[model samples]
Target: MTASTTRRTAATKSRIVAVGAIAVAGTMLLTGCGDQTNDGEAKETKAAAAPLADKLPQAIRDKGVIKVGSDIAYAPMEFMDANNQPAGVDIDLGKELGKVLGVEFKFENATFDQLVLGMNSGRHDIVMSSMTDTKERQQGASKDATGGADFVNYFKAGSAILTQKGNPKGIKNLDDLCGLTVAAQRGTANEDLLKTQQKKCGAKKIKEFISDQDSDSITQLQTKRADAVITDFPVALYNELEGGGGKLFEVVGDQIDAAPYGIAVSKKNPELRDAIKAAVQKIIDGGTYGEVLKKWKAESGAIETATVNAGK
Candidate 1:
């Protein structure tokens, strides 16, 4: 797998701010739970116990908080909001999962490159970044893998091509990129797909970036450094709708390589994995799942069931 860097400092700062705020909030929420007044007040203060709590590992139940590793740069999925708060589909879903597990979900921001490493190192209990569940990732075959991670698939996504508004280069599909310059985040399924497609169609110049920080690959397209950027369908659409102010980029072909985006867990933590799978299903059954997706305008990616290690 190719290694690349993400966006610049400003974006990184924003994510840090969001993670800090989330951490503070989680601490406060947990602290506030200990002081109950009267019987009525105690009842009101008490959070509904999760039926799945007994299923969680003893360590996690004792800790009362699940430390999550995430790359918060992916907007509409996981990103910083205007007030420097963590807000997005993944954040909301993780929070709901925490509630269902009767624990606080604390998000820690890291670069896309650091998440898997952090998870394997036990720096984080789980990973809620918008990571795609591919065979390579599931097998931990990348440069960063100490042990491969398992996935609890919760959302769906597909690869898409993004170009300048009106598609000046007239690129209609991946085939058209055969001899053109393309930009993609290194170590991603999209990059791998591009490489495979490039081989099949002769050769094309693929400009790989260190991270999918929007600034790098999108900048490449804006400056004509590359003819196109191949990324997740929702990401490309979100950039066009929100990031670019609706005037910078446009989606160029039907979404391809559609797959589920999974909540990654260490293969060593099957107990936690089963607990999360149940928690996600609870969220979906309770309708919180749909609400979160709708809030981010990502309802199209919502899956009916949360399955463990279901990635292809």
Candidate 2:
């Protein structure tokens, strides 16, 4: 959903094409992504020389590439830049981590809701979407709702409400949406928050206009289909600043549900999880993490240390 679901068709195709190129290079250069056959000696030698090569599982070590599933729509996290290339905090951090692991962190576009499920199904080696590390996800509460995986928490953020500029509805908080329509990305924490708010709305229950991506929700708000949109604080701020060249939207009220954003890794791949944890800590220590957040103006969500499933 990079650039939003409306942009999903073109952007996703661009990423797939970009990824296909990378995949092909991984094959041509690394001889089938480190096939391990005698013909792959050139790739093995180069890959084995990486700084953190010893930390990865032998199978992945040979591949020299980590398949990443990401929505790629949330700006400042993962998004396609004007150049139509993948760029953002998550993308930058993944690049640094890739250097340490001696593997190309090849991101593939997917709907935010499908990232974890796809990862669990073996479509990806990991998921680098801005996914929260909730307890239910750790225990695999639902096959599609939250993938069963270990989370390597890197950043923390809270959800916020985004309303159209000029305060048209005089909305200040969640309660204001009691009888209004709201938009949120399907399968996100924001969607859940809205549902919880609905119960309190009583007779004037909140009407929902859920979309596949946040941008679409923003579009709904722009078109007056929704009174407001709920999303991550950083995302709300980003849209408020960039949307309409900083004139289209504005953030209202305080944020809620502050929690760590984790990179999803299979529980079965403890080695990969631990390796990523270490790699992130190294990136933080090395100052690359700070640089990335600074570039995205997202230092507010920066975490002091990388941990596992630190979200409550």
Candidate 3:
């Protein structure tokens, strides 16, 4: 079967929030980690510091904290919980990374579009948001170039289509998006993909919103201003489960352009990059990695190893 076909099956079996009993079952499958307190499930026993901690930049070692820039609105990856504290798979990973590096992980919540700029400007040490590792981003070819941030891939994800719970428009895939209004976060690969597919879909209307927030796009769909929202697969799935209790929206298509999500560090900080990569692998081997993903109901996206600059 083709990748799309495989994705379709996966969506049907594991991710999509269908209507009626099927929707309840799909939501139940992932509810394992949803109700825990923000810090509850992510609180894993700390592992010994990895040797790479010694390789960290002196300034960082002295500071004893790795400042992370993230748009904390993507649920289950990085977002605020009931107590208004940052919590999610990425947040838990960052905490584990801190343990391995022998330092605290300090998150600096910023607009998604500002993350790269923040790193380049020295406002943040690393970005652990569920940022995709793409060729264009890794190359820093965009107008917002900050000397090309390097990435240490840690998870797998892809673009998926989300529509009203019942899929009123009969949307199935990109082919079905023709002439329809689609919403996606601005500056994200999802938006870029839609722009590229516009012509192929007979000039579909694409609406872009600030990357820091996904609610805007969801609002567009809910208000009938957009026929669908295209975003990271996990984000859409999580929203369907928690945002409206599986009643507001449903994933309609197979994931497309599957890619790795990476922890971004400035290219100037190769030492930090290598240190983080090693720390990540250490956690994966120590079992803490799986704990974090499982806590977020995102074990499906877990990676066995971490690779730097693996974008393609």
Best model number under lDDT: 2
Candidate 1 CA-lDDT value: 0.80
Candidate 2, which ten residues in sequence have the lowest lDDT sum? 1-10
lDDT of 2 by residue, 1-98 (tens): 23332332556776676666667665787765556576477657767766786899888877878999999888878889899888888999999998
TM-score of each: 0.81, 0.84, 0.80
Q: What is residue 251's positional error in candidate 2, in angstroms? A: 0.7
lDDT of 1 by residue, 12-52 (tens): 77667666666877788776765533433533233346767
Instruction: Sort by TM-score, best first.
Output: 2, 1, 3
Model 3, runs deviating above 4 Å: 1-52, 203-212
Which runs in model 1 stand beyond 4 Å of their true positions?
1-48, 203-212
Clashes of each: 3, 2, 0
User: What clash pairs does model 1 have?
Assistant: 4-210, 5-210, 5-211
